[model samples]
Each structure stands twice: as C-alpha cells, then as structure tokens.
Target: MIKENVNYKTLDLHQRDEWLHFVMKCETYDVFYLPQYVQMYEERGEGKAQLFVYERRAEEFVIYPFLKREIRGAAEGEVYYDITTSYGYGGPLYSLSRLKNDDDFVREFRAEFERYCKAEGIVSEFIRFHPYLETEAGLASYVNVTSVGELIYNDVTKTEEEIWSEVAPSKKRRIKKSKRNQVEVIFIDGKDIGPKEILIFYDIYTETMDKKQASSFYYFSLDFFQAYFTALKEYITLAFAMHEGRVISANLLLKSEGAVTIHLSASFKAYLHLCPNCNLRYECILWAKRNGYHIVDHGGGKEKDDSLYKYKQQFSNTQTNFHIGKKIHNQSIYNKLAKQKSKLVQGEQADFFPEYRQVLVTPRILSNK
Candidate 1:
C-alpha cells in the first residue's frame, strides 16, 4: 500500500526545536508528545529517543515520537531492536495544514512507514494512542488497533452542582465526608513547587508503587520528577490534600489546550480512611472547571474492568475509549522469541506480544488498584 519516493527519516536531537514547532501547529497534539517529555526519558537513559518524520510525496508530513530500546530476546546472547511509544499515550501527530481530513495521505504515510520499519529490522512497534486526540481510526490501516478501555473525564462546562450530581452516590458522600473530616485540598502552581515538596511527592509515589508490588519500570527517581516539573512548569499543576496541615495525598496534572490530564496521583495508606484521595480528585474537577479547562482526564485503568476505572467512574459519567496499536515487522525473529518464551512458561497461558517479555511482567502487579 505504501508508495515509492516518500521520504522518511529520524530526526536527531539537534532538530528537536523544529519538531516542537511542528507539534505546536498540530490540533491533536498533547503534552506527552512535547520535546520536554521525550527529553525526560532520554535523560533517564531509558532508551534512545527518535522523532520519525514521514513526508508523503511533497505535500504533508507526520511526526512519530518513538523510543528505540535494545531488549534481550528469548534467544541466548541475542538482542532485538524494538520501538515503543513513550510511557504515556503519544502516537503520531499529523500536520493540520497539509493533511487535514486527508485519509488518503494518512494511509500512504503509514504504508511507507511500515516499509521503513521492515527495512530496518524492527522486531515490533507498539503505540499507546493519544486519548484526547481521537486519531485511532486514521491509524487502523497501519496497525492492529484495539479498544483497551475507557478513560473517565469531566465536562468542565457543566455547573459545579450539575457535575457533582453525576458522580456516583458513594463518591458524593465521600467528598462531603472528607470536607467534614477537615481534609483540605489545595493546588500549587508548578513553578511554586520546590525541591522539598517534590521529594515529599516522590516518597508517597514510591510507597504506593512498593505497596502495589509494581514492576521496577514504573518507578521514577527524584531527579526525573525535578527535571520534568521544572521543564514543564507552565503546563503543570500540583494538587495536595492536607489533613491538619500534613500532606496526605497529592496529584499531578498537565494542562494543555483547555484539557487537564491527571498525570500522577498517590495517597498515603494511613490516610486512606479519611478519604483524602477522593477529595483531591473532586477538587481537581472543580479547579479545572473554575480555571477554564474544558475537560479533566482521569486517565484509565490497568484493564477494561477494574477497581481503578471504577474509582475514576465515581467522578464523571462521561467516558472516552483508550486504544492501543501493536504491530510486528520481523516475523521470523518474533516467532523465535515466542517459541523460546513459550517453553519457559510451562503452564500458564501467555498473551504478551513478542512473548519474550511475558516473564518480565510481575504477576503481583495485577491491577491498577
């Protein structure tokens, strides 16, 4: 399906500002696709970040932010080069001026892109499609896209009471009870958050991860947060829930284009009885409404049906589908890895793509509870 003569290349770090400029003109772009977000991962030494640009004929171009990681496949002493979207949902952002509503252009670009991946011996490619952009349909021609789950978000245009009424009855009661219990929720402009507050947030975040028995990959170091918040200050908001002047829970939000995304949130287990987390989320919705944000995305759960999703459902009745796109370019190596991994997993039914990574997934981190 890909046409010849299409120019596709990976942009180096030097061209980062150009890439950022392109993303700025995109109507569907998100903060996750920003240059600062990519730099954070690169600084962490997570992988080699690449911005793949695909120019269709001489008309339009699309930018795909990718991470190139050398993963040890199932074969002994063998490494496979694979690419994945960033930790957050960041797929491809297209040029609005050149390719607006041009389905043919998107199809041609994807086809050419797949050809390039095959030529480079990419084992596989995985994408966490943007939740707010609604660009899944445009990507269907290139990858196997699936509806993973639904994200919960609030319609900020609704009146405070109207929005509150949509919350599950129990949630409304919890918010009321949290206030009666003297739990105070406040928002700190990102620029005002200092090192001390960042450290405190990291402690709560790490503890929550530990208690949940999460994989090591989910853990972020203090330096990462400091760099991230500092670089993205203009777009971030830090919310804290305090009980008698002690911070009990905190949430990080990224505001962009009239939408606020819940980036990170954690609550001390000891304060769970006080419903501080609920108050924090409720206040976030109100803050988004008051500050002119049109929507507040609470992200999604680990699975389609889970406690985390249910928890988010308490705040809003509106839901948005989250999609994931996965594809394999090197079939022979993929099969080899799958076969080797299948041998190691004797009894359980393994559903992980590339299969070699199935063993790395910690069983204890079963859900986003």
Candidate 2:
C-alpha cells in the first residue's frame, strides 16, 4: 500500500539492467551493491534479492538493496519475512545531485520504508552499514544503531612516500625482510584465474581457516569461488605471493568505483617467518594507488583489538567505525516469534536483535528431588 505522492519502484534480480542503472547513477557505490554480486547470494539460497528505490525526482533518489528471507513457521497460512544485507556492508545510498537537506531526505525515506515493510509483511530488518560511507548516523532517529568495531584503510590518493611513512616501523622491517627473502608478489585478474589457481587458493584458505578454527561461515565451497570469478571477473583481482617457485600466500581484492577492498586473505602456516603477508599488503597498496583507487580497505577483525585487527593497523592508523542497524516494523509478529524462540532456547537473548534468529542454546534438565 504505497502512500499518495510517494514515487517509488521495486526491482528484483530479473531486472538487472534497471537495477544496475540506478546503482551506477549513485556518486559512490561499491561492488557489494551490484546486482550481479547480490544475485550470487540469492542463487546460494540466502534469500530473494530486491532493490527498493524511492525517487524524489528524475535524478535524485535513494536505492537500497536487501535480501528478503522468509521466516519459517512464524504463522499459520500467512507468510512473513525479514530483510538483511547480503553478507557484507550495505545500506541505503542516496543521490545528492539535487538534495537540499540531508536530514530531511533521510527522515522522509525512513517513513516510507517503514510503510513498505508493513505492507509487505516484513517483520524486521538488519543492516551492516558501510564504514566509509557512514550512512548509519543519519538513520539514528528511526533505526537502532551500534558501533561494532573499527576498520583500517589507506588513503591511496596520498603520495607514495606519505603512504610508506604511515606504515608501522615494525611492519616496514618485516616487509623488507620478505623482499630480501626473494618472495615475489603477482597479480592475476579474475578473468585469468584458472582451475589450478582456484585449487591453490582453496587449499591455502581452508588450511588457514582450519588452523585458526574459524567459524563454519568462513569455509566457502570451491564452486563459490568459481561462480565469483565468472560473475565479477572485471572487479576481482587475485594477488599471490610466490616464494622459490611456490605460491605462499594469496589475497582476494574486490574493486569498486573508487576503492579496493582486501576481502579475504590467507597464507601457509610454515611460511609465516618469511613475512610474505606483509609484503603482499604493501604491494597491494601500491597497486591500488597506481590504479587510481582512493582507498584500500583492510576490514576489521572478529572483535576490537584482536590479532587480526592489530595486523591490519600495522599498515595505516586511519580508522573508521563500523555500525549495524536494526529495525522492527511488525512489533507484534516480532514479539511472537521471539517468545517462541525463548521457549526453545535456554538463555536470555535480549541483546540479540530479532531474537528469534539467535543460535539455539541447549536446555539443561533438572533432576527431580
């Protein structure tokens, strides 16, 4: 039930051209916002990807891409759903070509979004906002926002000397040691990625994950990589560090209009002493700089100040806050689902948004006296 004077449009995965047009019109957008990228997630059975567009006029609008997931057993005979960003940073991107007031536009967008959610049986929504864009702050009025952690990035626009100076002295020593060891870094465009490279990367990445005891979510299938390369060849780059004729480390770089994201990286455990990872990052920074990218984003760790986060901070001190947003449109349905979840799980779940989706805790049985 769209309100009067609220000009808007909704596009699904089938409408690729129209969807891409809107995304390209935005002044700033990342690979995560692309229809092809979201389609991959949809094909993986994550959800049905949909782009919601609210047009203020011909050239000004707000476009939000999200995955609509069905809530199983939420109600009898009636269907309900929840929306979430697809496994990465994303939120509403606005066209500021003719915008007068940022706050005014956001407030109006929020009201209309809420209405759409209600009409479509959307109970709640979860958003992982982009750190660079900082879109969450403006929605603080309507959405619940929280700072998750901080991410490190290098402003590639700076001169090469300035960029090098920002690297921690200790890391600089390691990078030099890596170069002295004859460790060479090479870049392969996604189009050039072959089965052999995919197998090598998969082996290294899975081994690293095993040593770290990473969550199952980090263990991606080989087919996923194949699909990724096929769908996003132009925007993907594989950087491999070779030592004495063997690939020792690899990093998957995702490129956008103005930024390059170090999406995933791994190295052989035995080669840690060579500091191949350090050299790879430095080379990647230089590559991004030469390619006209403004920033090289080294995403945050699982938690603040963790070993992973500390490693990224070695390259640059510049940091940005990562935030997440939560919104509940159908309070009654949300409460019902949460209550049902509470009966099944053993612990308090007040802290988890959309509590019904929290991991179930096994219940303990009490001995009868």
Candidate 3:
C-alpha cells in the first residue's frame, strides 16, 4: 500500500550536509550516494546538479542526484533539457526499512518524478546503477535498463593464499616478473598527500587519458582532485608504484562499509612493459584482504570482452553485472529534438538517449596499458 500525502523536494549541491544526513538514515546505501562524490563533477563545471528528495513521511526519504544540461545548437535557438548521473555509480538511494514493499515505493516515486519532469519539459534521464547495492527489479520496466557489462570483484574474505591461487596464470607470471623488475608499492594517506604527490598522480592519469584519446569529461582539473582528496580523506587510500624513486603508476581506492572500490588508476606509458599496473593491483588486493575489507570492486572495461576486461579478470574470478538505466518524458518533444540533432551531426546519430547529444560519444581505439 502506498502512503498518502507524499511530498517532494529539490535541493541543489550546496545543501550537501543536509542531503548526506538524509542518506545516512537509509537502511542501505553506498559511498557513491554521498553528496561529496557527486559534487566532484559539479565542482568541475560538468553540469548543474539538482538533488531530488521524495518523502512519504518525515521518517522515509529517497534521494536522486541529477545533473541537468541544455541540448545546444539544435535549430535556431531551440533547446531541450536532458539529465544524467554524474560519473560513477548512482541511481536511487532510498530507505528500505521505511517501505512495506521497496519495488512498489520505487514505482510510485518514479511515477511522481516523471510527472514532475513532464511538467518541466525535461526530455530524458540516464542512470548508472550501483553494482554492490540492492535495487528493486521493476525499475527496468519504467526505464530502459540494460546490462552494460560486468564489474570484477575480488572476495577479500578468503585467505591470502586462496586469493593468490585464483589469479590467472599469465597474471601470476606478470606479478612475479614485476617483482624481479623492482617495482615497489606505497600507500599514501590523503591527509599526508601534498601538491608534489598530487602532480605526480595527475601527470600520469592525464597522460594515460590523452593517449587513449579519452573524452573531455575524463580530463578533470587538478583542483577537482584536490577537493576530492580533501573532502573524502578518511575514505580515500592512494597506492603508488615507484621504480628507482620515480612514480611510475598510481591508483585511487575508496573504502566504505567493508568494501573498497578501485576508483581510478593510471600508469606511465614507458613502464607498461615492466608490469607496474599488475603489481599495483596485486598490492592493493593484498592490502584490502589484510585490512578487513569484504570486497574489492574492479570496475568493468570499455567493453565486455575488451583487453581491459581481460586484464582485470586475471585478478579476480567473481563478476557482477553493471546496469545503465534511461527514461524519456515528453516523447513528442524528444522525437523533435532527436530528429533535429540527427540532421546537425555527421553520419547517423548514435542510439544514445536524447540523440541530440550523440556527438559526445567519440571513437576510441582502446589499448592495453
């Protein structure tokens, strides 16, 4: 049964502490649901963020953080609005204990939210669901939900020997060879990290993204990382691979509630042959295992069977599906803007939501690092 007098509220990114306080009340949640994580993109000028809160009673609330953008350059001054989840896992973080039936509540909440979007003339929405968290199944019926791919997970509950035994033979060889090559892994607390160390990580990360011809969205400013480290110091763990006193590779891990997510990683191009990245993962997994983390999530690759996925598979045998959800309101207007966008861009418009923004997706020939 649905509760009566359900109220809706919208809060901008500035009201972060209030929003996060609400998140902590939820029966289940993940670190990505934290406001600080979403603020990272907003602070970098990614888009205008609007945090939507749905309350059935004073005790129960669900929060969805959306980034809104105007579809520009379509016809003579015509514009359409589209929103998406910020980089990383995000969908809906709701109070499970507050609802009699989680699925029913989600459907009802989404219904009200759709009405709001339609009234505002917002065309569409996209979401990246949290892999480790539990979400209602019926959400797919309301939105275009599909398995993008699988994110790899390493079970930290196993003994160190058991964890090492599961590694792919090739990767095991690489790890041993990396040992012979003298790559050392070091963990730096975010609180202790300074501009010197920050620059080292930034240089390698940006250079790797540049080499892959990554999109502009991946080009985060140094200040963006600075704020992130400063804001989430307690949860962040930085791992660095050094060779002859030179930082050759680095990875960022976010720990919360007994799980560690392999947030980001990069390695020097010249050091790829030395297997610095392999060593980095090896060390991180060991650290997670010994530190009482229940799992280490190695996010998926560009594609299911891509070289990147193959490389991650060597570290863990457990796999979890990654899903992306999309929904469109105001279908008539959506069609109009999509048609205009198809004509504006070269070749056929990508099957992306709000086809007008198809230009955002660029061709990339991913190579192994």
TM-score per prediction, in order, is 0.89, 0.91, 0.89
- The parts of candidate 3 lying over 4 Å away from their true place are 1-6, 73-80, 97-101, 343-350, 360-369
After superposing candidate 2 on the true structure, give the runs of residues whose Cα lies further than 4 Å from its correct spot: 1-6, 97-101, 343-351, 360-369
Model 3 Cα lDDT, one tens digit per residue, 1-369? 123543576677678777888788887767777778777777777677777788777677678887877766533655667788888888777776446247778777787788668655577787888877734255766877778789999998999998999899988888888889999999998788877888887899998897889887677788887788888887788999989999999999998888898889998899888888888998999998888899999988977879889889989889999988877776666666777766542212234665766665674666576
Stretch of 10 with least lDDT, candidate 2: 360-369
The digit string of per-residue lDDT tens for model 2 on 1-369 reads 235766566799789899999999887788998999988888888899999988777677888999999999889999999999988789888776334247787777787888788778998898999888766757888888888789999999999999999999999999999999999999999889888998899999988887777766677788887788789998999999999999999999999888999999999999999999999999999999998999999999988899999989989979999988888888778888888767543222246777888775433333345
Error of 2 at 331 (Å): 1.5
| lDDT (Cα, 0-100) at 217 in candidate 2 | 62
Clashing pairs in 3: none
So what's the TM-score on candidate 1?
0.89
User: Cα lDDT of model 1 overall?
Assistant: 0.80
By the lDDT metric, which is better: model 1 or model 3? 1
Roughly what TM-score does model 2 have, to 2 decimal places?
A: 0.91
Model 2, CA-based lDDT: 0.86
Q: Write the per-residue lDDT of candidate 1 for residues 96-162, one digit (tens) a residue.
A: 6447357887877787778778766678787888877765657766677878789999999999889
The C-alpha RMSD of each candidate to the native structure, in angstroms, is: 4.3, 5.3, 4.1
Q: Estimate the TM-score for candidate 3.
A: 0.89
- Residue 319, model 3, lDDT: 93
Deviation (Å) of 269 in candidate 2:
1.5
